[model samples]
Target: MRLAEIPLCVWRTRGQTFLFRGQNIRYWTAGQGEPLLLIHGFPTASWDWHYLWQPLAQRYCLIACDMLGFGDSAKPVKHHYSIVEQADLQQALLAHLQVRQPVHVLAHDYGDSVAQELLARHHEARAAIASCVFLNGGLFPERHRPVLIQKLLLSPLGWLVGRSFTRDDLVKHITQIYGPQTRPSESVLDDCWSLIDANHGTRIIHKLVGYLPERIAQRGRWVGAMQHGDVSLRFINGAFDPVSGHHMLERYLELIPNPDTVSLHGIGHYPHTEAPGQVLRHYLAFRQQLQPFKKIACS
Candidate 1:
C-alpha cells in the first residue's frame, strides 16, 4: 500500500497539547469494552496493531495512537520525543479520557519503555491497572537494545543520520531485527519501509533514539520494583528476534511477580507483523489466564 493510502480514523479528539515534550497529542479509540490500550514500538506505527485489531477489538475497547513522530501524528522538530515525556503524556491521556479504573496496556519496543513510566506513575498515584501483557520488549535497558546500534544512537552522528535517514537505511536496519535464522519477506520489509516513509520519515528516528538515555536512566526503577512482587507482568516473545533477543526475557523472568514466557518459533523482531494470528492467540490466552482477582474497592 502507498504511504498516502494508510487508513487512520480519528478515534477521539483532544484539546491538543505539548504536555509530552510539546507533541500533538491525539488519543485514538476504536471498538469498545475494558479500554485496552495498544502501544507500538519504533520504526512502525499504529499500523503494527492491524492484525490484532479485528480479533481483539471484539472483546476490548481498542486504543492505539501514534507517538509524536509516528503514524498520522505530528512530527515536530521542537519535540523532545523521549520516553520520560511519553510516559507523562500517556497518563494525562487517560486522565483526559476519565479512565479512573485500571486499564490493560499492551506495549512493545519503545512503547515498553513508555509503559514502564506509566506503570511507575500508577504505583505512585495508587492507580488501578489489571496487568501488563509484555511482547518483544521490556524495562531492562541493558537487555533491551543491541550494542552496535545502541552505540550509533548514542553516538554523535545519530542526529545527522536520524534527520537524514533514507528508506534504504530503514530496510537495512530492519534486516538486523530478524534473527540470523529467519528472514522477513520482501513484502513485509516493504510494508515497514513504506510506513516509515510517511510523515516523520527518517528525521524522527534520531529523536526517538535520543530517548535511549531516558530509557537507561529509568530502566530498572519500575520493572525492578515489579520484580519485587509489587506488580504482575508476563512475556510473549518472538523466538527469532535479533534486536530484543530471546535471552532478555530470561533477564525479565528474574523480575516480575510470576513471569512466564511463550516463544513463537519461526518469528522475527516484529512478531505481531510476522505472525499476527499467533500473536493474538498468545495474547488472548494470556488474558484469559490472568489468575482472576477480585476488583472490590476497599473503603
Candidate 2:
C-alpha cells in the first residue's frame, strides 16, 4: 500500500514532531520494551519503515525519524547533509524522547552509512547501539557501483541537473534501483515524489547527494564499525539490487570477520518493501538471537 493510503488515523495517532538543530523533525514511535531505531536510506524518509512498523512495534519500541533533508523534516537550502550530522540528529532524537537504553538499529541504503557512523560512535563510547541490521546499502565504498544518475548527482554539474529534475526522472531512477519483479506502483511513486518535493527538496538534490563522497572519505570509520564493533551485526541483502546488492555482499564477507548475511535471491534494493515477510522473519530471528538479558529502561 502507498504511504498516502495508510489511513489518516494511523498518521494522526502515531505521527509525532520533534525539534532538532532548530528544525522540526518528524518522528514516530510505538510498542514497548527494548528500543529499536529505524533509519531510512537516501531519497526517502521514515515512511520507508511502514511495512515493518506494526510487526516490529509489537516487540520493541520502534523509533523512526525523517533526517534533515528528507521526509517531513525541514530541508535547509544550504545545509551539510553529512552522515555524521544525520547520526547526531538521531542521537538527539533519542535524547529528546528520553530513551537512555541501547537500541537496535535497522538501516537501509544511505541509512546504512549513518548506522555505521552510529556504531562507530558506540564503539568509542559516544553512543549506544546494541545491534545493527543493514539492508541493501553501500557499506563498502570501494565495492559500490553508483548508477549513471547517482554519478551525475554527485558531480559539480549536479546543480544544473537538479534544477531540471522532474517527477518522471525521479520515478525512473527510483524504479531502476528496484528489481524488475517488484517495481514500485504508480501510486507509490507519486507519494515518493510528493515527499521529495515537500520542501523544494528536488532543487537541492545535489546537496543531499553529498553523502556519496562523505561515505568514501569516512570509509575507515564506518567500515571499522562493521569489522570490529563488539555489537551484533547482520547484513540482509536483496541480491537483485544493482547498486549494492550481491557485489557488496561479496566484499562484506571478504572484509568482515565471521559476518552474517541473509540473501533474498530475487528481491531488489527494497527488500523490506518488496518482501516484507521474508525481511520480517529474518529480522525477528536476528533479534531473537541477540535477545537482551532484560528489557531496556527508557525514562
Among the numbered candidates, top lDDT falls to: 2
lDDT of 2 at 181: 83
- The digit string of per-residue lDDT tens for model 1 on 134-232 reads 678746777766636546756788777676666676667777777555566676566666666667556666667766677777766766555644455
**107-168 in candidate 2: lDDT tens per residue?**
99999999999999998999998899999999999988887878898888998887788889
lDDT of 1: 0.66
Tell me the TM-score of model 1.
0.83
Per model, state how many residue pairs clash.
3, 0
